[model samples]
Target: MPTDPQAYRPATALLTLGEGFFDPVAPADFPETHLRFRNQRAAAEIGVDPLTDEEWIRHFGRFDPLPDTLPAPLALRYHGHQFRSYNPDIGDGRGFTFAQLHDASGRLMDLGTKGSGTTPYSRSGDGRLTLKGGVREILATEMLQALNVPTSRTLSLIESGEALARGDEPSPTRSAVLVRLSHSHVRIGTFQRLAYEQDESAMRRLIGYVLHNLYGEDGDDPIRLLDLVVARTATLAARYMAAGFVHGVLNSDNINVTGESFDYGPWRFAPTWDPAFTAAYFDYQGLYAFGRQPEAIHWDVMQLAVSLRLLVDTEPLIAALDRFAPLYGEAVTQAILWRLGVMPGDPDADRSLVQAVERALRDTEVPIDRFFFDAFGGRLPDAYGTGWTEVRDALAGRTARGERVHPYWSGAPCSMLIDEVEAIWARIDQDDDWSALDAKVAAIRAMGDALA
Candidate 1:
């Protein structure tokens, strides 16, 4: 059944756990509330497409409580390992869970915020998001979704009319508040925090909450939860490889239990197949490089396993962790075949095809997105050379899914390269022109339609 556009089913499942898991906080008093962007498609799924621009700013920007929703925002509590070094002080420094509700598919979704205000976790830094940062996240999510990645959707971006200082970008830059729609806000770090406090009771409670609310499972089996999370995380890592995305920061806090990618920071789409390609400039050690993402994700899952030790036996957790390798291998194969738009063959043949495609991509050094765009339906030009011929042979006997009839496939694939992202922001920063951003999003969605 199609969802009733007027029926907005609000949920407060997280609030049922009480104040121990979070702190009630108010939003910042911004000087202005200008609606810079609003995702009508995402809003329609949540039954809020009827909200006017003014209403959007009023609710999202001003942090006004949505009707029958969260009475107030809750800054969630958690801890994380930064570059593998445990940090007990980190959580939602500049963000919070604004509200929770069901989507059209009846899945519980969170309406979370970024740059909303300072929280208990905001150390010495100011709680604000630069306008450029907000724009970058929008681009990241849009392009990832186009590639069929399970990612949080950018619901709205509101110019908060604040000037913020930062060392990363120019000082005193414009600021904004962003709302994202996600499946769950529960992270591996959330478990770590409870384990750190040695609160086994709270840890079990949290596990139960996740199992029931987010996963629709009844009883809380820590091993069962670990298995589910491991499988999802493995699939997520494969999707990242398939989409050519480098989520610069893969910290434990950034990884959600649902394995839906969110919280874009210093992210990049690889221009080529370079394994050493790092997204964040400060990643001097190349710890979270494009090629090393799978390892990093596996490491984060191990930390989750470590935290679950407070409630379960260690051997089962380790056994569950052991599943990562095969799961990731299988997922990457499926992901690559999906991207190529071809039916799968025998396991050996599919593996060979994936290997050949990777070799072709690396040896040719062609733009990754362009390669996928050009080679859609297993069609590669002769100019691609011997490496591509290997891929073609591997694709033999496999059926192409459908014809590439969409207009987006006619031209260059919509790519969110760093240069293009800056160009879009430059237009907005210099001439206050938003046409480029709007057009880019439309193109990305059209590409998604074609791929679908």
Candidate 2:
């Protein structure tokens, strides 16, 4: 429990909430989103105490008045196609952005949550998110951040007191609230809903609001707004590909209008080179597979364009859509080169090297996480020549009867930037200093930045 709740603040509170958006619905409902994992380390960086169960209830048990200057973050109305059918009555049902806060890094980020409770948008059933879902989100966010992907950061996961009935899992496991920090939570469906309702005034207002708040509009021209959204969406998509991440659901409702990645559900990185990988349990048709992510993003951009018809010229919107492939390609190339510790040059060699590594990896089928963590250092077992004979011997799978296996033993292909990744087999075969390996990765990253 935090002794002073005022010590922590959401990103929304950093600046005055802009005008006329009705405040987020009251947090009167006592729907319990459980306390599971509080990212205390990350929260500490933002000066927030991830409270315990007893503490959470004691502190944030009732709704607190958001600063009066900021517009109440009214749940933006939206409609979208789920799995391909148009569902008109969907929006933020349980969670809302209570406020925004500035972190130690000085970034003004939105502090929002899920499974907080029902809202005016809660249609027919209980508006709750599962505890397991919270766990998966934490795992996904941690891995994606490590890979340097642009993603919403999870601040804390709290287990709620009430039980939730979910068909996918056991009856009444528990509910949870995941506090997230992101640039914005506005979605494409927000525009779509207004457009569908022919609420052209609100749509225009929202676009102008987004531009002023997110992109820093220099003038009042709406075309500039379209250009910003298009460019941001393209860059975001490219980063997603470069990180080998597949956002399983790119629904209009889930696609943040600000072009930031949000709603972390059903996401996975490519363990191998297969483009067909999907992290969503129900994506049976591979709608949002790794290979299709770029196209999916473009599709989402198109949906935004359709909704933007009220505000921007159709010709410019079409032209912006055309920029998706090239922009995404360039972003992906740059990101991959950065990750591999190499500059983007000689496309032919890069292609060949990547293909070879992919083939090796497919053959080895080792865990990707362990592969990178193991060979972060430039030195490899074979690099030291005959001095590494014991390392070589151990790599050959002949060891003392009671000898323990090395941490990096998983068979896998090394990245092309690894000058001597081949030496990993022998290096791990010998006792290796993990801290030394970490320093090596840091050095490589620094070198990559210098080259950049």
* Candidate number with greatest lDDT: 1
Q: Residue 200, candidate 1: how far off, in angstroms? A: 1.2
The lowest-lDDT stretch of 10 consecutive residues in candidate 2 is 395-404
lDDT of model 1 at residue 139?
94
- TM-score of candidate 1 on Cα atoms, chains taken together: 0.98
Window of ten residues with lowest summed lDDT in model 1: 1-10
**Model 2, 292: alpha-carbon shift in Å?**
0.6
Task: Check candidate 1 and list the clashing pairs.
Answer: none
lDDT tens string, model 1, 122-154? 999688999999999999999999898999999
- After superposition of all CA atoms, the RMSD between model 1 and the true structure is 1.8
lDDT of all predictions, in order shown? 0.91, 0.59
Task: List runs of model 1 lying over 4 Å from the truth.
Answer: 1-7
